[model samples]
Target: MQQPAVPELAHTQTRPIHWVLTATAVAAVVALSTVARPGSATAAQSATGTRTTTAAVAPGTTGVQFPLDCGPVKALVVKKAGADLDGDGRPETVAVVHCDAPMGTPPDGVYVLTRSADGRRPRVVATLVRPEDRLTVTDFAVRARTVSATLLGYSSDAVPSCCPDLRTPAAWQWNGSAFIRSTGSAHSV
Candidate 1:
């Protein structure tokens, strides 16, 4: 059977991100698997018995990568937007950080980082989009000083990857201090 529809985001501004976002999420999983982990567990099983083997990080060798340390970040994002969010015309960044252990669950966060003179490092000026409020991020968009994320219903062990059930389009704008989702516009698809 064919999959169900993924409703486009509320505003037309966010629609372009749909295909890009969906493909990225799927690609993230496939891409990360190829990166050979120096030391990880392996399972060996035969008709007789099953044995498991694991290796620890070799003293100084960093295991995965920075973000991969948590989980393989699919469509890894540590920055967003190429425009100056502060009107300083210096440009800003948006990233998904502080994820849960398994990652992609509620309680995750989206951070807005602004350019700093100390270096090219971007400082976290705002934290927005918690997992508890919405489902998994299906897509995202940034425009007119607003950040929009498209969330689709997902369960830990439920739901086939071929079909996601619902879509809630949320938009959050900087309110002088933080990024918060605007009221009402969520719907199922």
Candidate 2:
């Protein structure tokens, strides 16, 4: 005996998969924008851990303490300088000095700590080598979209004591997602 014909489901009765997908995409965009917004208090708090010290630097100054693991080496000076190379009023520079000797010899490179936007603390962004070919970092600069570092080196031989003019400058620019080499500049010594 032939079985009864099965009933076909109507398209209108089915769940709208496209609607669900569109809703999910919209939610994801909203969530990403909310988390990516700059200067968000929540974002800053999440990036850095809890605050430990309440020492006031100034009348209206507030600061946060984060873990800094630099081993035994000490940083000589930490100061604020113009980071925004374009003169946009946004601080993109983190200048630091270290007396630590370079791995090679007498002339050690000065370590420059580059800080993020918040400017709470800094990390070793680059090194400037001395003019003696001793590999010491003398000066450096950081901008919102790029980081430029210069290294000076000199020869100690009797060959006229040539400095060689080894600029050894390196730069990186923000490429929408991450910092990448904007030009054909070499990133090595």
Candidate 3:
């Protein structure tokens, strides 16, 4: 066999000390990695520099007396969505309520609810859709300080209550003073 170009060095031989040194180097790297870590996460908004340790609870629909008068039957909340509709840190609830009628389709009243000054109860802040409008609320949602819904209504008085003939997509956004409604053109359903 031809002689190799380089001679074997002493370090090339495997020994117990070499194994111990390798293990020590690996252990040191692991220990140092454990000591160096990222800081604890925080729930804070960078824009407002507000630190929210606990989540803000939205206003609840229970016990809230909506502006609608349901007579003997109680007013029922059909759907609800919560968000910061007024740019406040606290969340407000947008509720779709109607009379708990035994039969026939009842008109829905979309109301914005906020916590009272004493935080004792949720009060109606604005009425997006009044019951008198005779409209049913569907595909409802509250996002980015806006309330959106698809309103179902009758095109004329001849249309039966069981089936709505007109469908309109509507959205309400807070304009600092009031919630401005932007309604899409109605279409027959």
Candidate 4:
């Protein structure tokens, strides 16, 4: 007797469906756990009166009230560099604030916040670089009251709109009045 023609079941296998459903159910459980179910971040935040993230710091700080309670804020970072840039005794704050850009571009601003000699009223000492779309400052460092940034896409055709290649470095030093371009290399932080 001739063997009956058997279609290959590789493409139409039914066991794979079972595995996929199982994986999906596992993922759903994990996702549900992260929500405000019981012991999640949302629940902990609600239990506490104060916002759990960055609180208003002590005196002489930039007072960066990270309002995490409202929701997930975008690209706004505050790096408290303990270096006393400008030869002041107090440390300065370096903040990367988000800038307006086109839909595909990512632009941000770097601000050097300095406090008065009275140790209060922190104000922006120098805006190292103004906000421009498609430009990126990958990393920054302060040495001898100087600021150098690992910048990308500031020049013409340096990087793409979204994915920036942070290879080129730029330096900015305080010229007694403002942060001027200086000579230095930016290392990845």
Q: Which 10 successive residues of model 2 have the least lDDT summed?
A: 57-66
Residue-level lDDT for 25 in candidate 4:
100
Clashes of each: 2, 14, 0, 0
Off by over 4 Å in 1: 1-75, 96-109, 131-134, 154-164
TM-score of each: 0.44, 0.31, 0.72, 0.48
Output the better candidate (2/3) by TM-score.
3
lDDT of 1 by residue, 96-172 (tens): 54344443343335656654455334455666654444345646667787777776664444765445566767777
lDDT of 1: 0.53
Task: For candidate 2, give the lDDT of residue 180.
Answer: 53
Error of 3 at 90 (Å): 1.1
Write down the TM-score for model 1. 0.44
RMSD of each: 23.7, 17.7, 12.3, 12.3
lDDT of each: 0.53, 0.43, 0.91, 0.57
Writing each residue's lDDT as its tens digit, candidate 2 over 1-189 gives 876597665665547897898899999999999889754231122336865333222111113221233356543343234343333333334343433433432333333234445655544444333223444344455655465555444433542322433445555554444445333332333
The digit string of per-residue lDDT tens for model 3 on 26-92 reads 9999999999997643236666786666567787899998999899999999899989888877788
Candidate 3 off by > 4 Å: 1-52
Model 4 lDDT per residue over 53-111, tens place: 42333223335442222234454553445355655334567666553333555465777
Top TM-score model: 3
